[model samples]
Target: MADDRRKNRIFRGSLGLLLLSLVLSGGCWDRRELETLAVVTGMGLNYAAQGDGYEVAFQIVRAAQLQSASGGAGGGGELKPVWILRSTGPTVFEAVRNATFQSSRRLFLSHNQVLIISEAVAKGGLLPALEFFVRDHEPRNTQWLLLTPDEPVEILDAAAGLERVSALAIVDLMKQYQLTSKIKPVYLADYIKTRIEKTTANTLPIIRIYETAGKKELLLDGTAILKEDRLVGFLDHKETRGLLWVLGEVRGGVITVDLPGGGKATFEIFDAIPKVKVEFKEGRVQVKIEIKERAGLGAQTTYADLSTPEQFKKLENLQTKAIEDEIRAALAKAKAYKADIFGFGEYLYKHDHRTWQRLQKEWERYFVDAQVEIKIEAMVEELGLVTRPATYRELRK
Candidate 1:
């Protein structure tokens, strides 16, 4: 009888321990349901016109509406897939927290893909506005950082073309920058990295809203040049590509040059490799950029047979001149602004530390007066499917 009582006690103890284990092993004690959170895909910062605070805009996805749209629900009463909310505070952190007062659910930012800053905020300085994002644990560093002249909220609210959300559309645009190589896409991390450098400046693609056919459209225009943390000037598309060439970021794009025979030919870039050398000579900084590029004949406006050896050589010369001109233009702009966007100062610092140290304090003066030489070797490898223009045979006939 005593043995049976001991067995019963042991069984009760085991059962209690099992129940406790079950309770403790259940995870997600503080997990919030998806319906209780607002998913923010894009965040924009701008200076408040009425006050000395920041105006923060968020592009929140309407989960249910997006689902219904993807599910092929055809109803005229369907709602939009995103909502743009604006909030204001004395600082970015406070502005973010202030959003909770307007939003019923917490604003979630882990899914954010783009961060747009207005020209006003960017011109004032990015460190003050970007501190919150850099210090926060939730915002990712991979998000594309863009500058805009228009209202940040307006850009966020612009139509997204095929995309349901404008922010995602902006992300797609950034990914396809290699197609034109005219805009340099800068991420939050990239900006931060350049900012940490003492002499290297930074660049960010410019995003703007334009009206086309009575519809608002988003466009990635030129580029914003920032010296240190403040916006200094801008670069046009051609100038931006020139900057890309020096940075060895040109992958795929088209270069059109006028032929000596009074027609134009467009060459699609297959490969381009830039070799840059920064030297201190004659008590001045000299930068030499040699770009070796290979391209194929994409299209021609003339009926001349460009496939011939003589004509191909001429095309290559023209292509080389075109590239050199672009680089020179970009260099001129950079020197005018006294901005070392090409990181020549950093190059000197790494290769010749003593020279960099002596000039680091007055690097801007050295950079403005720096002598730059550009050399381009362009090759026309392919002539596409047809040797001559399609109308060449007809013209010969």
Candidate 2:
């Protein structure tokens, strides 16, 4: 009887200990509540005029305001779905922490979608301004990075028609790069990786504020070419497309060319592929780039029937010329700026490392003088609804 009672007591004690362990593990002690966090959607960096420091802007989403806006109440009149918090400090990390002083909740950066840097800050060197983001565990490396000539903070405040949060609206705009393939949509990871390369340079899309009908709007314009971490120059939309072709990043876009006689014709690009070859001969480097593109007829202002073999051939030739022109224009602009936005040097470094070492120091000099051969082959596969322009039958003589 005594042995039986001792065994039963031991089993009960073990059961009680197990129950206490389960109770203790029920809740997460380190978990943070959502209400205590001010979720940041975008960030902007600018050179502060007050002192030698950075002025940081945090675009924090207002959940209550966003909910109200989604419900069609317009945030009960005058309330914005996002709050822009500003702070300044000697370093980017300090500036980020300083944002807490203006808000009751802690600023959480895990959901940040965009980082806009002012031209002034970019010209100096972006690595310093971006160091904190890379070192911290919060901000994601995949967020879109933009360079703005206007105040960086202005990009966060720009009015968006569809998206209640301007930061998200900007992200949507960047994603449209696939539709046009003109603006280069560079993420933080891509930008930093290229910037760190020995010869590869960095290029970021430019954002500016446009005032239309007394309301400010965000406009994505041009490309900011960076030599290492400093802003060297910019490439317009056309030149930017040319760079895209060289980089083989062109996905889809429309190319317009002059008709045989008059008017214009637009071709919708379906596929664009570029092949590059680098050759080192007699102490000089030469690059050959060939682009093969397939497009369909999208629109034409001319009544010329492109259904005929001769007319279609002419159309294909015109498209080829136009593609070549775009590539040439980008090359000319890059040479003028002394910027290797094409990464020809990077190619050589990857394939022919020994040769790259000899020219790495003076790569920019050799790049401007490097011989480039461009060849384009464009094919128009599908015509639009009709064999020619929409009004071809009505306007036929």
Candidate 3:
């Protein structure tokens, strides 16, 4: 009987301990409730009006409103699915912490998708304003980075349209670069890596606010050129495409060329391959770029039929000249700014470190005067559905 009672007591104590361990293990130690978080989806940075500090905008997602929108109620009564909070301080970190004074929930930034910097901030020097995002563990390196000539806050306020959150819409807009290949999307990691390099410059796409029927929308305006960390200049849409072509980032776009007779012909680029060769002659750096593209006939505004081999070769020549002109335009803009957005300096460092070392101190001067040759070979493989114009007399007959 004594042995039986002792065994029962031991079993009871073991059972209790096991149950307690399970309960403790099941509870989350670092859990934060969803209601206590103001999740930041996008951030905008600008120089403060006083010109002594920073103005920051945080686009926070409203969980309740998001849920309501997805349920087909359109946010359950007039409250948008996002909340914009603006704050100012001497530094970005302080500005972020200051947001808690007006916000009910703690700010959470791990979900951030994009960062927009104003021209003032970028021109003044981006490194000072960008330190926080780089050091903070909350923001990811994959976040899309953009520049705006107007107020950065305006970009965050644009309508989402297809997306429930405006920030997500901005992300989707960056993804569309593959469609037109007119602008290259610079992510946070790409900028950081380029900025930290010894001789490489960086570039960011420009975002502008467009108003249609009183509704403001986001539009990609041009390319922002950054020599080191400061904004030096900008490239227009045509120039941006030229830069993209050299970077091998052009996926698809229409290249229009003037026809021999009259009017214009547009070629839909199906494939583009860019090759760059750097050579040194008598200590002079020379960059030779060859761009080969395959395109299909998109449209011919001219009445002349271009189905014959002779006519096709003429059309190809025109397209080649047009491509070379775009490349030259980009090169001229970069030279005017004295910015090596083409990574020529980095190329030299990798291929010939000794030469790069000699020119590293005055790379801008060399880059401005660097000898560049652009060669283009555009082949129109397919002529679309019909070889002749739809309005041609033979087709009509």
Candidate 4:
């Protein structure tokens, strides 16, 4: 037994040594030089008006220009952010191959951060248009998906930032703003799943790039509402926040409430908890949304005293009312657009498939008319600094 064990150990050690030797001698597989690889930071899909098929645009990052572009250089010396390459074909794969007409090395998309779909291409049905992305093995699944009113190719070219181009800026925005803003970061996988599981309802963050207001910036505001993978309408910034509140994704944002007279006191929502309850009566379904929140004093333009517990309670009530107002407004707009971005339809489908089938055909209709009761309950913990005697110094006196 001892002899056999020694032999087995020797064989294992020898095999490990051989593998290490092979790895050390081997070279990188499918390795390409940085200059050879055209870094694809963003992809745009648009409709070819000529009826040729789909229009695909690649945002090729220019490293040479970007390297020394930020050294207090004027616009002339600044780097060209993206070299636009266009192709049209029956499918994304074919279009990608066609893009080689203007390139050399294989176009790499794994590092891509955003995918923009034009209104025309998305209206045709985003699922089929994006099937290539979902089914193909190129694009990252976590890529941020966006919808633009103009051709997506425009956004890819509208690189405007001191540090990085639009694509890199977008990648940073998604990472940072999520912690402090209620904008739901739209990912490619989430959007596709949202369409498949529910009544074809989802939202994509909207981005627009234009040399307007004396500045060129890639602005992402509100959300593009989609019903069955088609553009129906859009939500304003506040409406987007409300949608996030419904989705239980509210983290931190400022909520301003009007006081009794004319002053407006704003509170920063430091924490938020959304409670949604679904009930079924006979064959009908009802939803109750309870948005509970805790906030701190962000602004106090009102002369109202917030030192007392009663004063804090009043402020909490005021904030709650403001939150409810925004929620109602967002819900009304969503219903009018016939877009179920709140995923209420999805919840119904998951819990009760039978009722969902009955409601699927007219889910939008029911959603528009369905009685959704909303209740907001908020509390104020701290008023920034002094909450004991600042409001009424006379009490201390």
Question: Model 3: how far is 340 from its true place, Å?
Answer: 0.2
Task: Note the residue pairs that clash in candidate 4.
Answer: none
> Residue by residue across 65-132, what tens digits does model 3's lDDT show?
88876788763356988899999999999999999999998788888999999998898889899889
Per-model CA lDDT versus the true structure: 0.91, 0.89, 0.88, 0.80
State how far residue 97 of model 3 sits from its true place (Å): 1.7
Top candidate when judged by lDDT against the true structure = 1
Q: List TM-score per model, in order.
A: 0.93, 0.93, 0.91, 0.86
Ranked candidates, highest TM-score first: 1, 2, 3, 4
Error of 3 at 142 (Å): 0.7
Segments of candidate 2 deviating more than 4 angstroms: 1-30, 74-78, 390-397
Clashes of each: 0, 0, 0, 0
Cα error, candidate 3, residue 92 (Å) = 1.4
Error of 4 at 46 (Å): 0.8
Candidate 1 stretches with Cα past 4 Å from truth are 1-30, 392-397
For model 4, how does the per-residue alpha-carbon lDDT over 73-160 read when each residue is reduced to its tens digit? 6466554657888888888778877898888767888888888889887778887778888787768888998888877888887745
lDDT of 4: 0.80
lDDT of 1: 0.91
lDDT of 1 by residue, 1-397 (tens): 9999999999999999999999988986656789999999999999877879999999999999999988998599887899889999999889888999999999988888999999999999998998888898889999999999999899899998889899999999999988988999998999999899889888989999999988789999999899989999999999999999899999999998988758789999988999999999999999999999999999999877789899888889999999988888888999888899999999999899999999999999999989998888999999889998666264444
TM-score, cand. 2: 0.93
Candidate 1, residue 132: lDDT = 87
